[model samples]
Target: MTAAHAPISAEPRRADFERWRRRSRLIRTLRVVLPAVIVLIFLGLIGSVAWSTFNAQPRAAQVGDEPIRLISPRFVGRDDKGRAFVLTAESAIRDRLDYQRVILKKPALVLDENGPDQMRINGADGVFHEQSGKLELSNGVRMEDAENAFTTAASLFDTKTGEVVGSGPIQGAGGLGEIQAQSYGVYGKGETMVFKGGVRTRLETKK
Candidate 1:
């Protein structure tokens, strides 16, 4: 006859089943939470990038009161009467406030009006008015041609009328002789020049 065996208890098996069920639930919850966490991180990164871009500063543009300068400038034009004239300067600067005027350095002016004589003028500095066709020269002004030479402190030339006038002490030497005058005027397209106000002259004798 076989000996009878004792039956095993079910309590240990039931406890193992419960532990496995809990572990399965924990794994399922973790799977759902991990995807949500990844989505949130991606959204946060995208928002941060967008915000930085919106707040970014723009690049600055390059941008002054400097006057316009010209090197070796020449102006040639005809007067209202269709007479031609030429003005040249070693250098010139446009006036900051006056658009129709220019400051000239080492200026030389030549006027030809289809006349018997041409007028030439030189000055250390001058102002040329474009609208009025006038030139005001100062600082050792000199006028010369085939017949006469004059030196004065200042002179004004009117291109429209073909006239030159100066006020101040003038010393001139020409075919007539040496002359000293308080003022002088040249008109008739530079054909006639007159000296007035304390005029004195010394004639040169021909050999």
Candidate 2:
């Protein structure tokens, strides 16, 4: 009877001790794992931010709120008869991406008119620049105005003066005559053309 009474009292103490041991283990595990989880999350956030900074693309500069760019080869203008004028390139590159463009090469220009009226213009080996109101053709260039039925050479154009002046040799034919000169100047809106230096003209006679 005495042994049985002692065993019953020890059973409750053993159960209480087991419960306390489990609680202690749970607290210890949370204390160790919570800090480890927080550190891992902090490291992950740092790595993500660093990757975004290093791999990001730089922003392109803009001109007047409009991005500075070069246009691709395209039909930009029309002739008097409402025909299309196209730019023909030996090799053309077009990029509309993000409204930022870059172009290269001498592009030939073709007029909309037919036969002798159809013209082709090509610039010398150099970069062609397009400005606000006009196109600047430079570097040993040639223009075949088929409408006028002539091939002329020129370096610059003055829109106000309506003139084209050649920096080198120019040879061409018009409705009035055939011309050859060391330098040539043509009134863009008028028929008055002046050829200088070894100028020669062959007039077309009426039959």
Candidate 3:
């Protein structure tokens, strides 16, 4: 009896081994690349959401639906003798229902070419209703008395005696005096402007 031996081909074995190695490399490459792609997609989605949430907004000035507007306005306060003692800027917004009523009470004073003493504030925008007889001005408050000018964010002036009292920045110039006050109380019933708290006054004359 005789046995037959099979011949081995190294070329076939090498080809098969090369094919298997290529497939294995492809699978391993996918394992690393697929997770990296998924992580990038997740981060992109999160970034898009955060950007939309923060940037989506609008700035607003007025809160409600109202149709009232005012241009440059001026005001004047008079004394019992019919002489102008105080002058102020007049600007405000009000409901239509209360517009005429408000205007009639606190008329804006007309300014003379000369200055405060000869000025008249008779045009009205609103009235002061408090029993304490205080006048209030908001939104660009400016007051001019003779050579003096005082401006503030807002103010409370005494309707009875033309005095100012409140907490706000005030600047005034007149009668050889320059005043800057953080808070002030003006008693025009007297003859001088009084500055309170961090008051800086430059006097040009004593008399």
> How many clashing residue pairs appear in each of the predictions shown?
0, 3, 10
Ranking by lDDT: 1, 3, 2
Best by lDDT: 1
TM-score of each: 0.65, 0.46, 0.41
Q: Write the per-residue lDDT of candidate 3 for residues 103-157, one digit (tens) a residue.
A: 2223343333354443222323334433444555554566665556776666665
Alpha-carbon lDDT of model 3:
0.58
Error of 2 at 41 (Å): 3.7
Worst 10 residues of 2 by lDDT: 125-134
lDDT value for model 1:
0.86
RMSD of each: 9.0, 7.4, 12.8
- Give candidate 3's error at residue 196 in angstroms: 0.5
Clashes of 2: 3
Off by over 4 Å in 2: 1-37, 58-72, 79-85, 93-104, 115-119, 124-133, 145-154, 157-163, 166-184, 195-207
Say which candidate scores most in TM-score. Answer: 1
Worst 10 residues of 3 by lDDT: 101-110
